[model samples]
Target: MNITLPGKAATLMASQRERAEKQRARLGVEARSWYRISNAASDDEAEVMIYDEVGGWFGCTADDMIAELRQITAPRMRVRINSPGGSVFEGIAIANALRAHPASVTVQVDAVAASIASVIAMAGDRIEMAPNSMLMIHDASGLCMGNAADMEEMAELLDLISDNIADAYAARAGGTREQWRERMRAETWYLPEDAVENGLADEAVQAPKAGNAPPAPEEDDEPDMARAWDLAAYGYQGPRRDEPKTEEQQPLTINIGAAVGEDFVEQLRALVRQEVKDRTVAPASDATPTGPVAETEPVEPAPEPAAVPEPEVPAAEPVDAWAADIAGLLTTPADDWAADLTHLIGPDTSSRAAAEA
Candidate 1:
C-alpha cells in the first residue's frame, strides 16, 4: 500500500482546482449535475446518464446515484458516463451500489471515463467506450498542511487510498494488481483502442445514427500536469501528428538521367542528329562565294587554252636504294613505320629499344 509521489504534486493539484474554477465561471454554472434516467416502452428496461462531475454538489453525497437507481425496478439497465471524476470515495460507493444491483448493467462511455470515473465504469457487466473517447487512471491526489508527523500519516493514508483504487482497477482490467499499480503511478491515458487492448473496455461503440448531430465536445481545460505529459508523449492531439506545412517542406526534383527511360534513347539520338545537321547546313550557306558586278564593265567568261603536241622522251634508269627505302617508309603503316625507321637507323637495336621504351 506504500506509494511515492512527485515533489510538485501538491502544486499540481492546486493548479487543477484553480483551472476547474475558471472553467466553471466561464460556463456560468458549476459545470456539472448533468444526469437523467429514462424508462423505455418496456417496463423492465431503463437507461441512465451520468454526464458531469461525479458525487453531485455540496450536501449531495454518493446517495444521489443510489436514490436514482432505487426508483427503477428494471431487470436490465444501461449506464452512460462522461465525467471528469470527483470524490473518489463517492465514486467507489456508486460503483459498489451498481455491483450490488440485481439488474444486469451495461456501461457505455460517451466521451471519457477518467480516474475514479473509470473505476465506476468497471462495475458494468460489459463496458463500451466511444470511438473518440478516452479513459485515464492514476493514484489518488490530496493536499495536507501540517507538521512532519502529520504529513507522514497523510502520506501513509494516500498510499492506502492508492492501493484501494488499484484494487478497483485490477479487478476488471487486463493486468495484475502490481502492474495496474504501476500504470496508475504513471497516470496512464487510454484511447478506445487502448482500452479494448487492455481489457478495460469490451468494445468500441458504433458510429452514431445518421442526421443525429454529435454531442458538442466539452471545452477541455486539461490539467496542467496531464497536458505537459501528453504533449511530451503523444503530442497535441493524442497519436495523430500535425502534417508539415507546404512552406516547411522542401521541393522535390527528379534527375534527368535517372528519370529518362530506355525508350527515350532513340528519340534523344534523333534530336542530336537534327541539331548537327542544322549547324552544318548554316555554315555551308555562309561559305558560298559572293561578289557584285562593276557598273560599267560587262560580265565575261575566261578563254579556254589551245591544244599542244606531246613531247617524246627516253626511258629512265632504276631508283637508288635510299630513294626506294624512303618511298617504302612513306607507304608503310604508321605502326610499322616505327619498326622500319628502327631498321633504317642501322641496327643500334639497344639504343632504339631504350628510346621506344
Candidate 2:
C-alpha cells in the first residue's frame, strides 16, 4: 500500500495533469477532478471522493459507481466534493447511502461544491470546505414529460424531492423551510466560512498549498437533472422547448362511429318508441298552444263607406205678372183672343206712326 508515486505512476500523473490543464484552459477555468484520498482510511478511516466538472451538475454517475463505493470498507467515510454540482436525485441517493453508513461521514470540498453537489455534500456527519474552496446550494433543474397522469405523478415527485431537501438541509443547517425556499429560489451560493455559518457546512478547512480562500456566498442557477431523466427515460422526440409541457398536448377521444354502429334505422325506431312511451307516461297538454285571444280569427276589417253623388239644380220659371202686363199693353183688355192678338201685333205700329206725324 506504500507504493511510491513512481513506476507507471509518474507517467499516469503527468498524462492526467496534462488533460486537466487542457480542460481547464478550454473551459476558461482551473481544471478540477475528483480525487480519492489514498491511505485516507489510516489517516482518518474516512475517505473522500471528488465530484467535478459538468458531471457535478448531474452529481456523480451511479452507473456501476455504487459498486465502486461499496469496495471501500473504511471505518469512516469522507466524500470530498470538488464540483460545480450535478444531478439532484443521484446526489441525494449517494448522500442517503452515506447517511446510512455506520462510520462518521465528512464532506470535504477542495474547490467548489455547488448545486446538487452541495446537497450531496450535506449528507456527511461533518461538512467541511477549504477556505479557498466554495460551497453552493441551489434548487434542482430538469426537463419532464408524460400524459396528464404522468405529468401529475412527476409534479408530485418534485414536491416530495423538495420536501426531503427542506427537511434535510434544515436539520443540517439552522434555518426555516421558508428561508431555504427563498435562498434556493434565488439560487444562493455560499463561501466555505459562510456555508458553515449558515449551518450548511460544519467547518472550514484550511487552505493547503492550494487555494482554499473562502468566498462570499452568492447566488447561482438550478440544474435540470429531473428533466434530463424525463427526457432520457421517456425518449422525448419533438420540437425543442424551453420549459417542459405540463400535460399531454392531445387527449384521448371516444370513437362515436363505432359506438353508433350500422343499424341507424333500428336506432331511430327505438328512439321514436322511447319518445312515444315518454309522451304516454308523462302528462299530455289538453289546451292549445295558442291562447283563446290569439286563436280567434281576426275580425274582417269594416268595409270602407262609398262616396255620395251631389244633386243637380233646375232653371227658374218666367214670372206670370210680367207676362200679363205685356198682354194688356198689346190690345184692349176686354177684347177676345183675336183682338188680343191684333193688339199684340198692330197697336205698337200705329203709335209709332202717330208719333212720327
Deviation of model 1 at 205, angstroms: 1.8
Give the winner by lDDT: 1
**232-317 per-residue lDDT for model 2 (tens digits):** 66786866677665578546665433565423323333333333355457576797766455457778999988977867655433
lDDT of each model, Cα atoms only? 0.71, 0.59
Taking every candidate in turn, the Cα RMSD to the unseen true structure, in Å, is 28.7, 39.4
**How well does candidate 1 match the true structure in TM-score terms?**
0.49
How does each model score on TM-score? Answer: 0.49, 0.43
Candidate 1 stretches greater than 4 Å from native: 1-34, 56-59, 208-357
